[model samples]
Target: MHLYERLPIFVFEIEACENLTYITMAIRFNLDRTGRHLSLKDWQALPYAAREALAGYIPGDDDFPARLDQLVSDHLGRSPDTAGDAPDMAWEDTHALPPGLLAQCALADLAPPSVADWAGLTPFRRYVLTKLSRRTDKQNHCFVPAMLEFRLAQATL
Candidate 1:
């Protein structure tokens, strides 16, 4: 009936006293509905990239999520920065805002619009750019792309 619900309720075979990795349980569609396989044909049908990504998973690795995020980015030629809220970034050696962001915006003659766009961003969005800019080792290759991405997004608005 579904694709995942059939992952074989191995828990039922294990004694209640045994330790298992149950975090939460939810009902989902399962193809077998009685066994624990992804329907081999279904697995084979997945794109090669997707299969490779799945093959790379290492159970119990703390950085698995980050690795997967990077893989997805690499596959799509996406910005290296994770596309969400950036942690707090306070610049001690540089100007308040990242210079590369400004320079790129100026080069495009979109400074005014970019500034307006940056100013109008929700605090979280602004934080993403600031965090990217603040990474000392990556400033040369990062942030500008992110800024341009935002600039393009703003253009459409």
Candidate 2:
């Protein structure tokens, strides 16, 4: 059985990154349990805590290949033959950024070496950040907490 389908989280691009002996790849999930798959890039861009509570990877794992395989088999039972890609309609709008959200992003503390990597993210990721950073009186509790969580996750990753 192929590895991705066996895992509860369906990740793509399982490859050894650069010269590193370890493997690295982006993972995707039908995370809401609704069969709606979020892109791996978008998934990683989400707050790490949420990712963990939702579908977090094991941290500081040394034996990743075995760990990943076992986790997949335990979670998903079997790998499927098809690796589905998003429909063409899923591309981002990539329009001009709103100044208000840009100001909010300016305040985020990304990991030091990659500080302010916000603009480097894809348009959809930027849109999600904008939404999370939006000022809201009622949902302020919700978005505010997410912003903090995203920062914390950034540090660990």
Candidate 3:
């Protein structure tokens, strides 16, 4: 079983769900590292569900480091202190855009208006929207609407 399987899961409220009592779930992982050691590449490589599940736990707090340590030791069967080493590729905002989105930006020629609008977005928001845009099946519909909303919001300023 995967390490996540053994962890207790909890349902959390999400505004995206209109009627559902629980729109998201979480599985706490045990690791010594906090958000500082996490990489965007590592996060993107995770399955969508796992990514969402892990999001709640990413923002480490007082007990988080210890919990992470325990998770690594328990799941990976590694030593508690082993997770302190950062991944080879460090996490950065520039690398947050998925490949397809980067291609789309290239194709669209990313007008100054769009670039400016996108630049104004918070890193997290930009990350999410870029990922959404990068998806192969729904890129146009999903990304265009988000872009429009972003543009409209920017126009108000």
Candidate 4:
């Protein structure tokens, strides 16, 4: 049997980052809203307490963008950019890779995962793959590594 067969279905390791910017990004994605822009510099400049609060805050309703703006204004001296509509994607589709992400995997020479394989992943992992494969990301150094880490793709020596 292959070594991967002996491993758990998910073995995620938390990667350390210098700022809370990605948390904000994940929040925006989860909320399906946008335009409360916080620059990376601004994100890094916030006090740890503020950052923690923002990261931990989950909106119980659809008013999250406004709430996020309030948080940003509390930390910074001014309101952030106004909230706007974000594109809705197939967040619930687990049977196949999204077209963009599949294309990315093909470009990387990774095998197209089976439907069962796709459904095996948690939503957060799926979101990570989707976010990394987005066209505007510019840097995708993490894509293949993330795929390998998730055991959805093989590593070529």
Which TM-score value belongs to model 4? 0.64
The worst-scoring run of ten residues by lDDT in candidate 3 lies at 19-28
**Cα RMSD of predicted structure 1:** 18.0
For candidate 3, write residues 1-157 as lDDT tens digits: 4323333332111232222222222221222223333333443444455443444463234565565445444544553333454422211244344456655544544532344454566553454454445444433544544555555223222
How well is each residue in 1-157 modelled by candidate 4, as lDDT tens digits? 5222331222232233323434443454534445455656776777766665555544233555666667677777787764364443543488667876876777777786787887788766676677667763343777787788888888776
Q: TM-score: which candidate is best?
A: 4
Indicate which candidate wins on lDDT: 4
**Selected candidate, larger TM-score, 2 vs 3:** 3
Which candidate do you rate higher for TM-score, 1 or 4?
4
For model 2, residues 33-104, the per-residue Cα lDDT tens digits are 122344454434444333333332332233433433444444445322233543222113344444434444
Model 3 clashing residue pairs (backbone): 30-68, 30-71, 30-72, 31-68, 31-69
Best-to-worst order by lDDT is: 4, 3, 1, 2
lDDT of each: 0.37, 0.35, 0.39, 0.59
TM-score per prediction, in order, is 0.27, 0.24, 0.33, 0.64
Question: How many clashes (backbone atoms < 3 Å, residues ≥3 apart in a chain or on different chains) does model 2 have?
Answer: 3
For model 2, the superposed segments whose C-alpha errors exceed 4 Å read: 1-97, 102-116, 133-139, 152-157
| lDDT of prediction 1 | 0.37
Ranking of models by TM-score: 4, 3, 1, 2
* Candidate 1 residue-wise lDDT, 1-157, digit = tens: 3212332222222242122222111100111111223323443444555544444333223444454445545554442332244323432223244564455445544443345455666443464455444444333333444455555333433
